[model samples]
Target: MASKANKELESWIKHLSGEDMPVFSGTVADVTESVNSEDSSASEVAQTILRDASLTSRLLKVANSFNYNPGGKKISTVSRAVMVLGFEQVGALTLTLALVDSLSEGVQRHKLTEEMAQSFHAAIQAQQLAKKMGCKSPEDIFVATLLSRLGNMAFWAFSGQKGTEVLNLIQSENLTEQEAELQVLGFRLRDLTVGLSKSWSLGELLDDFLSDHHGNDERHNIISIGQELAEAAKNGWDSEQVAIIFEQAAKKLGLSVDEVEELAHQNAKHAKEITRIYGVTDASKRIPQPNIDMGLIEEDVDEAKSDSTDEPRLTITEDTSTAVTSKYPEPDSNVQLTIMQEITSAIEEKPSINIILEMVLEGLHRGVGMDRALFAILSPDRRTLTCKYAIGEDNERLCKELRINLSNTNNIFHQVIDSKKAMHVPSDPKKLTGTLSRDTLTLLGPPAYLVMPVIVRSKVIGIFMADRNASGRDIEEKDFIAFQQFCQQANMGLTFLAM
Candidate 1:
């Protein structure tokens, strides 16, 4: 009964669905089911999310961000956030974060992070527009729009260069994204989303919203208009393209052209705040301001860069594991020095000792762009190097397996602790020595990795280990220097805690 395109899409869907798809939190699944049951409570949903410290921090950050707070009192606790934004909104946010966290691993994180920021921005804009149009429960609309974009996200994440070809074709030939996707990938991307939504048990509303039910379906038009404005603004706010998109959106939302343009500007500003909430700082910095000229936007971004710990280089994510290269020339020493200063300043805040270590791990994982990072503290008696914090896929497994026995004090980790030197071991047995436990080696997935000891008062207190793992980026000397410096700053924080 299916058309060739439909059949082909189903085949692709089957392939993707049958593959080990990323699972969101078990709590997300359970909480959603419990919400409809007889005995659901807001406290129950809040507790589930709080179980994961990272997710809890993320949710608190979003709840406290300017987008939601808007000069209101800051919401400090998860219970307060849950009370303010109803269970549905909190559940939706939890699902979104879980989805992002699950899918971001073992892929090009930088590229996924950009796409995720845009997707979140688009969903927010669409939801606001839908709410203005008298759609009840725009949160459902928000999650639906986001879920319907999974096919595009998956293509960009796992399809690699082939996906880029589809993207380039859309730009070069002026083809619709779906048209280019069909030509390049043998199926329309939306159809893949359709299949995935059904398979993933997302509500049928996603299908209806993504459909071509134009006249009676204001939701579809609102989402389309949001995407259009977002795409147009990416070109330049002052472009003729922006005027056209705004005109279309104005008609759909029953607003004047000026009103629609004002809405776009507001969304742009709010989107910037929301982007920061999710820790996508680079993407937040690059958000286009609808009223500002392109030149002024650059100046604003540069000014922001002055206050942050970033090196000003445009990064292009490629299919290759080592593909994220800066477009500009190599940065000078001042760049690293600036980031170290930022880290040191943050450490001076003297957050809880656990929070301090997590911040350092994030600095390595997100700032330094490592695929996997682990912070392993020495046991009280200094008998074992036990992974205490990890960021990446299979992190739980890594933590369990990366328990390095210090009984063999001649092992590589022990040697690094003794010498207080960082080591980057490339794919050489001579380089490996007794450094890697079999469990650690198995997790590394490649022949090489890097480890540096976290020393305090001239005594090794922990180990900082990171690698590209199956992503396959070879360790570079520059990256090692950055990691070593990160560990050094971490030591200062640890010492402060010790004192």
Candidate 2:
């Protein structure tokens, strides 16, 4: 009986899939899927989002919103918008708008309105509070806090259960909101939200907010305070619940209660301004101002969850200076994936050194779509790496003669072998003078290339090198990931062949 009950609860979570939601249009879905992919690019995702004219306008409006665009520079295109707002943020915002549109419909209209209003109001509060705290990724916190309640709000909007009954059960039975949810709907709203958040690949930060709730952490406190304050605002500012929440928040923020009050009002003002952008259509039904109805007591915010305030920023580095200096264009992703598949299949059926080496070179050339690729075997004594297989040059004869000594050198190729990590070398020798030697540059056919070491159980065995050569095509993060995965797979095949 217990097992059957558990499955029933899990079913509710399964129903909360992003696919079933009305907001997940194919374009929005594509951006989510693409940005989450290891081989996809911001520019590539931007291209897909651009296909939807309405979505493009929405993205630009938010990107050029007073917050993201401070320089007054006009973001004229979707591609530029994606760059400005960040691909992940753009994707999250797309989902946020769509989700509100879906959940704001149907029977639980009043209840749904309350939840959405609280979520948006709290999100803006968390964002402003986070900024004041010197948090690096305030935007991340804003999105996470807003989405934290997505599961509960979604459930309330969908479950057809009376909100009053759920609330009464929690109070009368002394059951937690999640406990009441399990008894009523067979699953926690958090279960639905966390599951869908991961499926949509919202960001790891949201995952942390949902999963990590260690007490005394500023991030969790910020989320908690945001929720509490939303309820306080709903009840009117001078209510007992609001006073308690403010007292607690004041302690965490190390501010006077008066100061906290000021910030809360300011946050309310901003929230009112951002309702349209955040998909809250009716601004008139805003958070009940503390000033307007002082001491009017209301119930606590229901089934709301916490999110993190700390920022984890990941930088996607592109060589801004080298685009003009490099001569070759980046490899196409489809071609790269196809080539990698072919290499994997060829090596699996025929694990011979020659066959594997040939396929690898072919991948680097035709698969990676690079101009040249070479396979060099490491000597038994680790004395040298000598080019034994080559492709993509007018003379494969000279390509075969290229060699590099194992002696200590500042060049990237040497670093790849020493560090056992693939290294990216773009055009512009002067920029990389700390590593690449003039002689090494002379040997490489292209100004840009990647050198990855092939290893077998930690022992360096051989080298895979390729470049656009004189064309100087700079590698991107996605391209680098593809190249690295190829190297790892090739290493396995080479290891088997060597045995």
Candidate 3:
């Protein structure tokens, strides 16, 4: 019987790996490999995502949503998104979106919708529990819990006759879920989940939970509780099953029963919101809210839809819609102000120089509406300037290519370093005594760029450069002023560090 089950699982794996779910499988593999790599950087992950325009837009929208960015800091670029949301969180989001997009295509079924809804609810519940327990990586728990039932979701989503048979057996014969799956498909869906998780190299957390579902591991326990809660809540929060699960969770978490219940209820609502954000509107509607009446829930959803259409709650300014749809970013003064405030807060903490530079780059790229922004630091001997941080189009390549030799004072960058004055090339190219170096023009493309020197202790130490070369947008006077303001903030940060 075990051998037969194994054979059946292998067949299902082969079938799923074929053309039916190529995008989902490929995305899981690629994202997992990118994040798991030892040498992985945010740029690499950003590059992987920037390849798909649709994915990039969807990801940015979700990242900026109130649920993720409660502080209202606008995330304008994929690189910034990766920085704001940790690498693991971004990977989880990408995988979740891919899964939803894949399953949501073609025919829709009630069973598939329920399974997806449960997955979303379970993930959010597990993530909230992990946070309450002070787990270091709540995103891992969320992803693991979401994928715990991958086999069931995938099978029901794509299966035709076999899926109906399994459901009929469970309903008619009053058989257990596992018994029905085994009788109809010759293997349990749990076994299929294990196989898929292994084949895709999902993660160690998933592998650990699947291999030992009843282990002493705290994370595994949280995931188990989340799944149980999601299933029991279907009978409504006032049901005896929900009460039992709450008692169990209260004991496990060392929280009062009321606190556990409150946490679960809040997480359920968040699950619905996040599910809709992932573009699974139908599944989101099915996630049961604890105390809210169905009519009220529907009314709330309609209001949310209306609000999203009239004025997106995610962005800070009215021009955010332009920023989203246009090739060039529109200047958002509100985002700039928020980011500047964050920079001031970061400065007070006295963090590393890299932290300050990253925030500054984000400001220039997102807040100032530059197509590309870069910070280059002078070598100890002051002979060369190397790109230290960058954000925007082709940023990884820009980092590699942006190098300036200061020995040649005839170049535009060196002139800024020498004079300690900001230069806007498009405003008046002839005002500068020196010309742009062949390397600079070749790498940065054309004129219409801003360059500012970073002066500390009355000496130039680095430079902040920005341009709209990618989108070929004109750098207006206002943009130049914003760029200078951000550069001054960088100068202030560096001076504080020097002190």
Candidate 4:
């Protein structure tokens, strides 16, 4: 039996990682690796997300949603989203959105929808319970709970003959879910979830909860209650089973039974809206509506619509359909303006220099349509420059390779800093032959690029560099103007901090 189970698990894993959902598998792997690495910065994570324009837009929307951004602050860029929502929160949201995008369109979509709805419902329930218990990170609990049933969701999404057989066994024999999975697939779906969690490095909390479903830890107990409530609520919020789960949660959370009941009801409604925000509208519709007052639900819906309208919409010069299908990003004036405003707000609020740099880099990459953008800070000794934050293609490699020796006054980068002026390198290779060194050319490629000094209080503190090499597009006059403007904003922000 053990051998059979191992083989079955491996087979299912192979199937899921194969052609069925390659994009999702790749996303999970990329995001997990980036988020889990000790050296990974928020900029790195943002770059990972920004590679997919659709994912980027969806993540920003979720970050700006009421549940995530209660303060009503608009998140225009993925960099700001990472800063505002937190690194783990943004990573979790990316994984969630990727999962929905990958699995929402496959075969047995109805079953997938049920799994997605259940996960969302349980996630919200767990998050609410975590908040009530005063846990340090409710978002962690939410993500852990949502992905707890990964095997079940993935199975329904990509499984073929074996899946139908398992379903048939459950229906015909009246067996429980695990028994059906075990009889047909040689292992339980829960075991598969544990396997996938490990392989994907989803998180320690998820692995721990899957390993000990009935653990004594308070956080784990909350997760268990959340999943149970989601399952029981399928029968109805007022069902006896739900009542029992609520009673247990009330005791665990040190809350009255009435309070637990109310929280559960509110979370159910919240889960519905959150699922919709995630672009899984089908799953959102499948989520059971709590037996709450109709008037209150209507009021909530109206408020959500109003809040959405207030969000700054992206405005592209090209037609909407063409822009969506275009391979390269077009300059978005709306996003550029919004990010500029955010930078001003960050300066007023006394944010970290890293935050200011990140926003500027985002402005150059996404707003100004640069194929690659980076911020390189001068070493304290003032002898060398090193990349601190970067975005766009091959950013990780760019970060490591982007170094300039300040003593080389002949270099264009050094000249920019010395003069405290912005320079736009034309695409003509002849113009860069002497001024641009061979090492710089190898690192940045031979393309039109922009370099500007970030001056604070009349001192050149750093430099901003951007290029259109990835897209092989020539640096336009407007791009240079926008790049200079963003660098100026960064200088102003740093000056404010110095004050």
Worst 10 residues of 4 by lDDT: 312-321
lDDT of 1 by residue, 206-307 (tens): 767766655667777777776776667767878999899888777767899998888787877877766566655655666776666788756754564464
Whole-model lDDT per candidate: 0.66, 0.64, 0.80, 0.80
Clashes per candidate (backbone, < 3 Å)? 1, 10, 0, 0
lDDT of 3 by residue, 1-499 (tens): 8888788889899888886677788888878887888976665676556545456668878888998889887776665677678788899888887777677643326667678889999999999999999998899899999999999888877777887798788889999989998898898898989999998788999999999856678999899999999999877778899999999999988899999999999999999988888777767887998876656646644655455335422221122443265655568897688778777876786866766777777778767888878889899999899987677777777788888777877877887888889988763566656777778678878788899998887888899899888887888899999999988998998899889
Write the number of the candidate with greater lDDT, choosing between 2 and 4.
4
Better of 3 and 4 by TM-score: 4
lDDT by residue (352-430, candidate 4, tens digit) is 7888898899888888988888989898887788988888888888787878777777877788887888888778767
TM-score of each: 0.53, 0.52, 0.71, 0.89
Show model 2 residue runs off by greater than 4 Å: 22-41, 45-48, 67-73, 86-92, 161-180, 198-201, 294-499
Q: How far is 418's C-alpha from truth in model 2 (Å)?
A: 44
Pairs in steric clash, model 2: 9-186, 219-309, 326-472, 327-471, 327-472, 328-471, 328-473, 446-469, 446-470, 447-469
Q: Residues 390-435, candidate 2, lDDT per residue (tens digit)?
A: 6555324434456777676665667778889887766666756336
- As a TM-score, model 4 comes out at 0.89
Candidate 2: worst-modelled 10 consecutive residues by lDDT: 305-314
In model 4, pairs of residues that clash are none
Q: Candidate 2 at residue 217, lDDT?
A: 65
